[model samples]
Target chain A: MHIGALHISGVNLQEVEQKVLDVAVNIICDEKGKDYLIVDDNPGSEILVLNADSAEGSKILNNASENQVKIVFSSSTQSGKNIITMPTPVRVIALKNVLIKIAEQLYAYIISKKGHLKAVKKPTVLPEAQKIENIFQQLLQIKLANKCSLISSTGLPSIYIDGVNGRFITEKSTDDIEKYLNLDFNSVESKEISYEQLNEYSKNMPVAALNSILWRCALACSNGKLLPGHSENTPVKLTSWPNFSRHGFKPDYFKLAAIMAKQYISLMELNRQTQIPFKEITDFYNAAFAVDIIETVTDKSKLKKTGPIKSSQNKSILKKLAQRLGIN
Target chain B: MLQLNTDKIIFTGPVGAGKTTAISSISDTPPVSTDVNTSGEERKLKDSTTVAMDYSYIEMDDGTKVHLYGTPGQTRFDFMWKILTKGGLGLVLLINNDHPEPVKQMEFYLDSFSDFIDETGVVIGVTRTSINDQANIEDYQAKLFERNQIFPVFEVDSRSEGDIKVLIQALLAILAN
Candidate 1:
């Protein structure tokens, strides 16, 4: 039976093409005896007839294999068994059978290889739009967590501040701080203090007591009320032990803040100790201040000017972090 | 007969993070799933959740077949998490950004599979990030950093074949390294 258009590529291109066409129509024609379009230059032609002995045929075969395009070759050709081949004499029936067989084999191969062809492409670096979106997301989370808000200064419900016991004992009537601390509010004096007075009162207290009072004060602060003298260089100390699991601060930051609270540390010192970004430290500072867990040390003489820390050190730390992340 | 030559990678995430959909996207064959209708709180997110696991495979031209297994997201089915990771070469942790606590969920999964992760490698795919970008890949990376971990994290769409491939490819690359 006549196969469809076959591209003849060999030393004797014209002769092969004509002979194949005649054989296809006269002896191997299909039920309708239709003429096959045996072209010499149709690269898109599904069927290819290549002479085994010719260099051009070898090149075509190599090209086809590289492109994953199957071709019909003369039987004498030294090629893989997976390739389709027919005798060089161009017997009419043999040619017909070989063409039909190649078509069937190609169909089966295509069917079997469909899944392999569907492998998806690899992803590239995130685009700027995606990066901007990511930043927006982080900001939203910070806002939702109230990490971005300033600690309120006044009208906080009366909390019992006990320096000797190292606790900011709150009234049993208050639901906010008690839910977190789970402490008995009984037998404690309830007093309301302004942000300035609380800061003044915390100056003489032990670090532990200061930690408790400040954390309570921070918790008591109204949302968006700025803590007094809250600045990057402000000397601050953690007053109480940080409950990491409860607070949800990153472990490293929590550890750094814990270290800072034990000893009076300026915001800059905390940043240097933790290598955490200033903005993050500020967020933590605000949160800590609002809850009265952190207090500013007014003794400027104790705050030695550690000098200007190099951004290179911070860069190296970031580089190390990026390296750990396997990002070049 | 024991199929010792077969290799596999595990997929895990919170409920509705698209673990099943991810496997189905890249699997050469229709994946086998043991999903059932989600009851109680989980139903609010999706109708069905994977009860046991999801399974599918991709056969390379060199005759190597890599199996994909997805674990159930809910903690109630966490028992299957360890079971499915028996022969896994690595893990692809898919976190849904739109979830109430995406970072918390990431930490939970990483902790749950820390043993397997310590043995093999892991790559994270944060899905639905476009829907809610508040908890980005860096946030997850920061959490991993706290654990002293460094993993490839990407934003992916579970329904996209390309995104799933990128996630799997990143895991394979980590394994190769």
Candidate 2:
């Protein structure tokens, strides 16, 4: 019997042709929903055929509509699909007859689903952009040219830095420093201070690395955005590692720093590789840039994804193990 | 019963870096361990130490299993690292942050398993920072940077299940990377 187009999934085409010696079944290939690819409903039309012999096939089958027909040679059960099970040692003619019938049903199903469709919008949460322009960037910018001790303030809410020596003095504790750095850059101003005054201010105070303090400031004040010059799309690597131990870091920072230092990766690529939010990767870049650990990567060939490749079966097994151990 | 014969993840580090403890924290079954009393200066740090590989496995729901093997931390057993890592998935190198030169010990392991790591991948877990706090994570990362290599180093308390799990997950993630 002549049949119409079919988006046949979980079935082999060559085996079907070998079975149906004389019947011509037009196949329309598509990468979309396995069953919906064939839309035409005529006496004879094009069709798409798919076979569920592997994990990828199972994925397509699982995503298929519950109403559409599912044909399987093995005795495997799909959750909701109308499965037409065939024994493993079935005759060739039986397979061809099943295909013809399934193709006709799939076409009629498509014709029935004329304009009923809905767009699925995925929900995404983005970090809010900070309202204030920033205070640390201006101070850090002047740090390059001043060539002397620079203090953001003279009193308790202050930062004492000697960039040349890599020593910094800050009265603001770690918890309060972010608050102080978030203030409007226009309102507060930094001034050049004498070394004598810097020494006196640092008395009984712990002298830490300037980047140790500024790394925290850069991350907090940069507001989920990268500083100019370093594009997210172009690859860059860290010349030196960020001091993650000295201060608290977002979890993604570890992977980002490791991946970037291992090889040149664009910030966009970093986010993609690590599955870390783009905002967090941007913040990491800003902090790394402030610490002078960033270098432009001229050779693009150095880019190779770091991580193990696994088959879908192994991936599921890993997921199950992670869940059983409560590691997720 | 079906068994995954080729799946293995190796754990190795210096003496008293908590290699055995890290394995116990993540393994589904109690890890079979072999340890002996420490002598000389090593005795000052810990009472005993692992002298051979600790073996354990976690059976996934679908009957697939991931085997965990922790090598002896003593330098004398360096030959076993390669044997244990043959056809392994990745390496988890634990370093005692309290050690005088934890970075050096880390370097030793990294060098010892360089070929395996180049073929597979590795994750570092820094244990016992509260004891002495001599070494830091940045120092380890800097050394890796200097060596032109990079791996995730985390401050992990080997006794804490969550910490060891995170380390394993990091190793698995990079292995998957």
Candidate 3:
């Protein structure tokens, strides 16, 4: 099967052509003739990017067809001449090389099957949750009015994110919903129902602010990556702060938030300043982004070097107080 | 280990804003309050009010004591407001969202404590936001933005110790930054 779209698992795909590294992405492969499914976890993805370090790499590699360029995140020791293996946390330049390789392979395969197959559209690659985020984003933008219910494979109660009221309508307990926020949406389809139907079912159900679910979901599914538009090299600041009281606190979230509110710094630079883990910082970014508070720095000239933030006078006292309050 | 009064945090806002409850939430011991029955217009909102202050302390493991002082909310107690804020590290301004024009109340507090806020910093705790539909966290932020103010604002319940700590933690974080 020619790389119609992409299917991904594990590794967070980097951007190609300023879009996510999904193969002929956003376009659905409607017809199925056992042609090929890169199928692992990615919903609309055709290319299957596996971690070469993972045992599942070789097994899935063998399943890929000629037109499909299967990518593996190779470790320092691993090497394969016939297959594509880029480093983990693939650099932009390396990702470009892979895109070139995929293009060549796709063109050759298409020439071999001229007039046999149809064409598909593609965009920057995205993880499964990013695609799901697109739906929530449209709801936020007021462009999408489709009343839908999200159903997962686990047979849990269906959850409805009511864009109208900015609430979640569900019979499921908030605790249960939080637990499954990192839900696999590959096979999960949001059953679009009528507005009347949603109202009838949601009348008596427990409701929560939709931002709470979105906030936690972003944290759960971020997979240590920022959204496609957010560049790792670009600094960011918050236009508004997350309502931590409602969203529930993650450890050190306040610290990262303090920095975000005060300075415009990239995640890497923020990590250096605060000494908080890079992954945790990205998780904070995802949550902040999902809550719609994060803003990328518009002017590089406005970015200032973050100096020491600890108060000169109350440094000791603040540390003591933070310690007593269990935040230190 | 008890090191007395290295720094103090001032909790202030309009009447019924939960300063006393907030102080008690993170205090090491029961707060000492000079609460008395409310009079005239204020009495309609609550039975009693703090005429002076609510005093509490947080003691570190090594005996450093950070003080917490809650100012009386009524403007008539403005004399004690200045007195209580002295030697303070920052302010925790709690606004009762259920009050008519809670954002206005915040503006009043910010104006009253503008000097103290400038010297230190302030974190706002918008209490009773759930009970009030007229205002949300964004409205408070919008007010701050209009005033060219940048401060952390949280939707909080003064009764929740965790919520109280977050406010204080955010205050500390802001000061550090």
Candidate 4:
């Protein structure tokens, strides 16, 4: 349960380190032990905390070509790729979470170095239809946990039973949805809804709820395996921008997806580019696919190269002008 | 009376969005600023506020002069927003991410200049993102999408000439399209 010896060093981190050590019983700050290192400008530490705006932080980061060190930057802004940054006036919860992640990484490293790590056998794959059903059941579980009704927006039970529709009308008001539901499912004994039917019903669900269901479906359909159309070798592109406003998705999710879809790049390539967790990226892609916002493009020609503008000449002029005005 | 035949780009946003700083960063000549000492709550943030407007200019390689006009940030002076936008080729809206309600501010400015945005073009430069990460570039894009508008949004340090240039280039690209 003990996270190995951790060292803490940084101009801004003195108080933070004291507070963290007081609360985190497992983390030990020791200079003698090399299991885990936390530093600002000092090299050889596993975790580097640097002030984003300070010259010292910049100098250290520039000189850090070391491999296998997890960098944690203390800044007032959001953390970028590879490094985990805690906002200034660091919160105890955020620090604890970062430590937990570091502990997991350390455990994995130790196991690999000891050659004790073994590959687990893959589970038997379920039929495509059955897999979708499994996903739908999971979605139901989520809705139930959230105290949401299993009934579709159209007032019919989302989960069909036998040949008749299940009768659990959560909302008694007879609106257009109720009328449509009654006309569509005349009989009560309808079997389970298929994936396509679920997708169609999604249009009626609130954007937030629909996004949740779609994400769950993607996870279930893929069965923890690479999706049929997605792979580490193939490049993926966005067919269209996901209506984040309508979908109630965080715009950041769409931006990441758009960046990946702009060019044909494998998920691994995207991982390298963004340094975001592989699982998170795959989950987002799966959700995007379920909502029909992205596609796999075999033709490389279709991939648009929308890189940043090359401004070597312009940059020089701007730099000189900025220096003159003391704007840098 | 002599009039300068120069195309202009209007920079407007809520208070403390760094419009004046951005103009000063890229302006070839010293900016003509009408700033007054602050006496109210705004004084807590800065010592001065632009009362009227700030003006500067840049000369392109082809000798085309592009005038930069910065509108006063407070809505009390919003009467000048339309006046400043007149004959403007595009709008550069700089939003301060540290503001309590950046998204709301974004919507207000976008709606305020919707007609101008539609007629010409608009680019958003979010300043102080390094200090405030609550509203990132993607969040701005989402807000724009809600209004059924598509515009380029960049995270910029208004004082950085390179960062401002990137924003200006994005605006130019949008105009070209």
* TM-score of the second chain for every model: 0.93, 0.92, 0.94, 0.93
Tens digits of per-residue lDDT, candidate 3, A230-315, equal: 66677887756678877766767888887787668888888897888888888788778666466565445657745345557887
lDDT score for residue A145 of model 1: 25
Q: Is candidate 3 or candidate 4 better by DockQ?
A: 3
Docking class of 2: incorrect
Q: Candidate 4, which CAPRI tier?
A: incorrect
DockQ: the better of candidates 2 and 4: 2
Candidate rank order under TM-score: 3, 2, 4, 1
Q: Is the docking of candidate 3 incorrect, acceptable, medium or high quality?
A: incorrect
Q: DockQ of candidate 2?
A: 0.10
- Candidate 4 ranges with C-alpha deviation above 4 Å: A1-328, B1-6
RMSD of each: 34.1, 25.2, 17.8, 24.6
Candidate 1's C-alpha runs over 4 A off are A1-328, B1-6
lDDT score of residue B65 within candidate 1: 66
Report the error of model 4 at residue A274, Å. Answer: 27
Q: What does DockQ give for each predicted structure?
A: 0.01, 0.10, 0.21, 0.01
**Deviation of model 3 at A174, angstroms:** 3.5
Question: What is the C-alpha local distance difference test score of candidate 3?
Answer: 0.66
Q: Taking the tens digit of each residue's C-alpha lDDT, what string does model 2 give over B1-177?
A: 112345878888988888888888877888888878889998987898777778888887777788888898888888777778887777888899888889898998898898888887788888888786566565565566546565777788899887877766665555443
Q: What digit string (tens of lDDT, one per residue) describes model 1 on residues A89-208? A: 454333443444344344444445653342221111122233211211222222222121111213333333332112333333423343423222232222344323443454443333
Worst 10 residues of 1 chain A by lDDT: A119-128
